[model samples]
Target: MASLLSLSTVVSHRILSLHPPPLNRSLLFVKPKLPFSRTVSRDLRMRLHSQTTNYGDKEHKPSSIDSKLNPLEGAGTKNLEKVVATILILAQVWSPLPLFGLDSAYISPAEAVLYSPDTKVPRSGELALRRAIPANPNMKTIQACHSTRLFTFWIPQRKPYGTMESNVKKALKVAIDDKDSILASIPADLRDKGSELYASLVDGKGGLQALIESIRYQDPDKVSIRLASSLDTVAEMELLQASGLSFLLPQQYLNYPRLAGRGTVEITIEKADGSTFQAESGGDQRKSATIQVVIDGYSAPLTAGNFAKLVTSGAYDGAKLNTVNQAVITEDGSGKVESVSVPLEVMPSGQFEPLYRTPLSVQDGELPVLPLSVYGAVAMAHSENSEEYSSPYQFFFYLYDKRNSGLGGLSFDEGQFSVFGYTTAGRDILGQIKTGDIIKSAKLIEGQDRLILPAQNNSSST
Candidate 1:
């Protein structure tokens, strides 16, 4: 069977599936007998993603993923690894990236396990015992029992009883403090449980959850805001900064993580120089408008606070309202569609979860308080280039209620952008506004203390 299976025969030719290996050499993709035997080649794994379009439901069903392959000799083992190659072959033919209704499009193998949470412990006949995970992951009170067979494809090798306990603890501390201090801290006792410690850290409370918490949760404290209602539509938005907007084309700017925690503020938008107006009032006379925005300080502290601080500090002054496509109000620099042009933010310690600022959204059993589903909804403008919609100081105003216009509750900007504040007053001003208008003044009249001023952003995209 091993002799019969070749790349040409496996792919181009319709060879029968399920090539079981020799009875003794029957293997799992899990820990092979030799260390040199990697489950998947780096190139093939990347190709798997490069060629993959859809992820969820594209992978073979667990029941269908039978690990049967021909046992190979020396050179064959080195060249055509049967397990990953077979998977790649099947992946190329059937192209299964979608496994268990999940389309995890990253390089991390932990994604599937994190999303697929099954706490059921295996019985004596089963593969391994069950360990209970934390319900509210941040809650420090997690029941600590070690389970071996949960989301893994193959049973992990048991380390010698106490060989690497201290090493794992040190590694975990490094992974936690270095990569993510945001995760709830673990107690010392939990560190003693072999690789289970590492498993728990990444299983549910790691980078994967940061990306997908379809069920959102609200903070204990809540801040409700009221904004004026009226609108327009444009695709480009502005990222207001402390210096206001200097030139539409800033060479580079500092990048930071989103402001988190909760607070309040009043955002005021004023006119700027070189401003032209075609007021909603029948193209009447020169119109001067002051827009006041009240943001719920308690919700989405990082995003809301960042905006509020910029307003209070007068960084948004002189910013241009550059784009008004139909009804969307986008404040791009120089009337062009572009962000501040800062490179991708990379943490010094090599964390990839958040490359830039973004709003907390649909996850942990909750919904967003501010969504651009209605007229006068204010949200941060983000780049459409990357999977992340979080941008520096870009935000815009939706001129009309998209939901009433027949988009259901989902606005074109709803899930992607972060809605932090609204036009609490001066809705009529929004009507009079046109592109190329300068923000004469953007001030924060209240709730200065509520804003969490991030430690001057030390991270850079350079």
Candidate 2:
């Protein structure tokens, strides 16, 4: 009966140990895997002992029991203290949690496990874990964890103005040596981005004004300016040989009377391949021909005599048409025609001459001998106004367009130019002429101070 009672007691104790009372509701279900020992109640301890005896026939080894009990034995003091210290340190660093006053005695086994720093065991993962915690909870920790990111945002942003100003001054100096260098110094990226701004600051009108102002204020005398001048002298001479003038003959007359004898002349053409040909008497044309006025005895003898002198001297050879107005006779002369002033021929002083019965009449097949009446006829050219007359080696042609007549009777009344003859043939050639053409005097009758008129063949000759 005594052995059976001991066996029943042992079985009851084993059953009680195997089926211990439920854990406290406030305790954590999954405790932290902290490096700490565990502590069992007295009731749990006795039940464990009985279960050990009933589990196997052999006695439980003391070393095994000691090994099993060692963890619980030390959990209450040294191991628990280390765990609590680790948790406190971690809380202080990670958050703003108060660690000054706390009852560690009331801390449960599960709560004690929470204080362990198992999550931060690895060195690299500690920083990351700390960062995950709220920064407001632990300002110092967050700052330490994200020092690089915080510093980057906290720095001030700017390029020193002093440095920029110095660069500008240096660039300006370099520009003095080489104007383009100033543009080169500008950063390429900025220039490309702010091209208009650069242009305004550099070479635009405002920039120029600024530069000028700078020069005036900084180096007054060094500023530069340029000055300039021009001169022209126009002297025109006109020469005329009326039956009344002799010693007054132009130097051209004295030199080449033969030229002065002729009525009109051509000088130069102002066209390519002869488009609008010009003559001494006429302005411009597409084609042209030459005309030679000869002093014949049948014409006014005294006039012919005076003309023959100019022709023989070659004065009128290259003379130009001085003036030409429509319905007004064209005037030609030697020398710069403007230089020679001819006095007007006044009417005969006293008209008490004897009267003759026979009237001057024209013969058969003859044209009446009348004073020159042709208007704008080919003649010599002269300048505006003057006295000393010497022909220029140039000429112009007069177009008989009859626009100027009522001003004065078409005669040598102006004393500026003289009309000797007209262009009879090759009028059509005038249309094919341009500015310049050579004017040569036709050879006169040998030993005769007159031109040999062509036969009345009626054929036009060039």
Candidate 3:
């Protein structure tokens, strides 16, 4: 046994010296004493030769090299043969262990922004409408300036309940189990109002009270009606909350007219046929009918400001109304002011300020702070030449019908237009209005203090 071990060591050294360079340096030396076979198979010899040819010398062809090395196949050399054969077999199937860490494949910012799961472009009707409008080169710099975070303009303090009136509506939607928690969460400043609201909701016999009773009675139909009516209180409360606008108007837009806060525009309409609208039981039989719109500067300052300025200038006075499928648009060029058109302004939900000239991608989960889904929503008509700008004078009252709208009860043009206000009063009067109805007079009754006009152009054309 001692003699055999010594002979095997010498044969291993001889084999290592004969192969000057092996595929792997560690594979060149056989340290372990393995049993050996007198005759090595052709298959094993061919595999070792193949490995050498692939990893080492590309020019070395597979031939009878094992026969020339057969001189070592003498007494006690079986151990060396077994060691080389075992090492070669293991090397053929060996692989490096996999690594694990926090590292992952990288994605560029620009590419990430463009990436989306939606296969189609402009998935919603509003998005498609906005994209159908031609892109203006002049707006490139302005869009970049507004979207970038470099300038860091001061965003207005968010109201405790919410910035936009819509936020107040969402805050009110709560399960019965969460009623106490919601009531407790009201801000200190609004505590009194919140308490009054809570009392009215629980005991006033209105939609909220009815909703709770319906749930207790387990009536699905009544619950549905009460829930809808309860949610609708948001529109009524919006007008009463005539609180100041919660967002800051950028100084860059000061050159143009802007309303930094809420304003009320009262428009009196009369039939072109000179007929009086039916009056309520206690109201006077006036020939002209009146409607009030509460313009929101928080969501759309520029658009609301421009409309308010035009109202003060009497641009809409005596303007003829043209009825379309789902909207009542003012006739173009009727008291049309030749002022610079305001860019398409839409304040996205969860955003600090309005996005100028760009419309929200509603299908991509972006919605406006002032949604167009409500009935009697007021918005500016798109410019005849470019959809990127709102027409300076002409505007419309959207007659929203849930049946005619897209999924989720959103208006077809939900995010396409600049919705600055809603018809707070006389929503029923909208259905009574006919084509060719005349806006007998238009006036800015409130929010004159919030209107900001340039010194040189104070006539209120825009």
* Residues 211-255 of candidate 1: C-alpha lDDT, one tens digit per residue: 112112211111000000000000000010011211121122223
What order do you get sorting by lDDT, best first?
3, 1, 2
lDDT of 3 by residue, 1-462 (tens): 334334334433332223212232222111112111111221111110000011231222222433444545655656756665445323322422211210112222322222221222223222222222111222222122222211121222322212222221323343234555544544567657755655554455454556546555655456456544543332223222334544566666777788876778899999887776876555665567889988877678889888888888877778887664456767665336545578789987657688988977654567776767667878887765456777776688877665544323454356778888888778778877887889999999999999988775433323
Error of 2 at 284 (Å): 20
User: How close is every model to the real structure, measured as TM-score?
Assistant: 0.36, 0.23, 0.50
Off by over 4 Å in 1: 1-286, 326-330, 333-367, 384-389, 402-409
**Measured by TM-score, how close is model 2 to the native structure?**
0.23
lDDT of each: 0.34, 0.27, 0.54
How many steric overlaps does candidate 2 have?
82
Q: Deviation in angstroms for 253 in model 3?
A: 1.5
Per-structure clash totals for the candidates? 46, 82, 0
Q: Tell me each candidate's RMSD, in Å, in order.
A: 21.1, 58.9, 28.1
